[model samples]
Target: MSGNRLYLSVSLLLSVGYFWLGWSLMQPEPKHNFTPCLFKNVTGIACPSCGTTRSVLLITKGHLQEAALTNPLGLLAAIIMLTLPAWLLYDFFRREKTFYNNYSIAERFINKNKKIIIPITVSLMLGNWIWNICKGL
Candidate 1:
């Protein structure tokens, strides 16, 4: 197979595996211990991505609110997890950056407002981190 095809196949497999692993981890008697978040382990503070795994697990189990409370970014991950396969399939057929082309206007807006965007992103991350810490995740 060509390199691009091989890469897409590998990516699709890994994405599916990730979702399956999340589902398996949510089982009633998971046989493995959950790994603590590395950033939290060293810093003793919740990172922006803290609780993301639990959030994904909760989302897989149909607990949307709990998933959001666990970590909003987890919701984003779930969306990506669900959509990536389709996107990859489309990309494999098209072999073009259609997503970027279609969203060029939005991309230009982001580039223009990069300074403003940075602060907003930082505040949102900080807020999420604070919420995670409050929940003692």
Candidate 2:
């Protein structure tokens, strides 16, 4: 297969894996062994993306409150998990990369709003970090 098709196939596989993970975690007792987050293990603190897997599984199983409690990013991730495969499949069949073509717009927006964007980004990140710390995750 061509490079684009190869990438799409890999993407599909990853999506399926994540979905399977979510399904497995939904069980009364998860049978899989989980590796602790490396950052959390070394630092004694939850990393920005820590709890993401649990959160995704929770959200997929319709446990939104639990998902948010696990990780705020989980909500965003769930949305992406739901959408990205369809997006990739659409692009694959079209034989064009629509997702990659939108970068210039984002770049222009960032360049125009750096002063406003930087502080907001920092605040959100710091706030989320504090929340994670408070949760003792």
Candidate 3:
């Protein structure tokens, strides 16, 4: 009922979800086409996330270059998104007090750099999108 307990519970839930998500990656992906990007249908430009899933699939299939051509940001997205939940789980299980301790250096690094890092990441993804479009992906 306290804040720390609540956080611990949420972390456990996220850990379970991440475990399932990671497990699902080993299974077959479903076919779906519901792109919200107008670039795909209008100007014929590939959007930043246009082939993200396909790129991830190709990466899983060992087509590294093809994946990069499809979405250069795919690996970055995959690592951050997937690793976040994994880290949450790790902290929950390991009782990593550093995650809670404000003095933790890793926490300090994230807090200090996230603002600048996000915009740079966004720009990179957008650049990759334009590149993919130019490549006729």
Runs of candidate 1 with Cα error greater than 4 angstroms are 1-34, 100-107
lDDT of 3 at 72: 67
Which candidate wins on lDDT? 1
Q: What order do you get sorting by TM-score, best first?
A: 1, 2, 3
lDDT value, residue 17 of candidate 1: 57
Candidate 2: clashing residue pairs, number: 0
lDDT score of model 3? 0.67
Give the per-residue Cα lDDT of candidate 2 at 67. Answer: 94
Give the higher-TM-score candidate: 1 or 2.
Answer: 1
| Residue pairs that clash (backbone atoms under 3 angstroms), model 3 | none
For each candidate, the alpha-carbon lDDT, in order, equals 0.77, 0.75, 0.67
| Better model by TM-score: candidate 2 vs candidate 3 | 2
The CA root-mean-square deviation of candidate 1, after full C-alpha superposition on the true structure, stands at 4.6
What local lDDT does model 2 show for residue 91?
72
Stretches of candidate 2 exceeding 4 Å from the true structure:
1-35
Best by TM-score: 1
- Per-residue lDDT of model 1, residues 38-112, tens digit only: 887787778889777778888978999989988999898888777766666676688865544545667788899
For residues 1-137, write the lDDT of model 2, one tens digit per residue: 44556566658777786866657576676465443678777777877777777788877679999999988988887787777777777777888776545445677799899999999988887888888888977
Model 3: CA > 4 A from native = 1-44, 97-122
